[model samples]
Target: MRTVLDFTPLYRSSVGFDRMLDLLDNASRVASVDNWPPYDIAKIGDADYRITMAVAGFAQDELTVTQEGNNLLVGGAKTGDDSGEYLHRGIAGRTFQRRFELADHVKVVDANLTNGLLTIDLKREIPEEMKPRQIEIGQASSPAQVSQIDQGQKAA
Candidate 1:
């Protein structure tokens, strides 16, 4: 016997969360788990993030970074170890797949592998038109309007 978890009910109940529901649906089928390569996700700034994975045994050529739709996929497959002549192969040199959920405007800037660490940078660009702007409040009176206010105050 198997248990099936239905999320459609919850998704329909959620308000102003259609995109999030879509993300959740996509994540449900995304490639994750079992292939758990140790990783760290850090928010570098208000709109910037960094994903660093400890891929020690994997080389730059072995690793691949790509974006499928709105998801970032980091995968690696160690190659050409056909002889299998390792007496003590403690290090993990097998294939791994990692998926990251990205926001609507988030994009992968770049990925680099150095000293066994694979670092992927992401940036969310809020457009000038979308960014919040401050409105300066000044005294609401032109020279003519100020005279009228002064006269009213004096009369009162």
Candidate 2:
């Protein structure tokens, strides 16, 4: 299936959308969709995020979280029970997959499963060069250094 993305017209007016176009191109190449175990992604802090998935029948031991380059891969498989009888099995009980793309320097801090909620925490580490710095101002020693006095002298 081909998606008609007429970004050329949009790209002309939106200079900020250049990166978005690259992301959309990457998304077009991903030809798989495995929407097992509905999940949610939330921004917890300025540079932190969390991904929560509703894995009701899955235990912590059954799930796995892995990081491959710039993407986070989450998957799980339930061990079959030989003794348990399934008279009416409606829920899905197979391996599930979920992928999330991370920005540069973003990493998974930890993953925890609590009360059927699997939460994956991610934090983006800002580079020391990228952090904001305070620039100190010096007191003017000469009257000419003051911009108001300079303008007054020019008027005179």
Could you give candidate 1's per-residue lDDT for residues 1-156 as a string of tens digits?
434456688866788787877666665764535646899999999989999999988888999999977789999998856686878877877898887878878999989999999999999987788889998999776899889989999999
lDDT of model 2 at residue 146?
A: 84
Q: For candidate 1, which ten residues in a row score worst on lDDT?
A: 26-35
lDDT of each structure?
A: 0.85, 0.86
Candidate 2, superposed: residue stretches over 4 Å from native: 6-20, 29-32, 132-156
Clashes of 1: 0
TM-score of each: 0.68, 0.69
Candidate 2 residue lDDT tens string, 1-156: 678566678777887678778888778877777677889999999989999999988878899999998889999898867487889987777788788888878999999999989999999998999889998999757765687778888999
Prediction 2 global C-alpha lDDT = 0.86
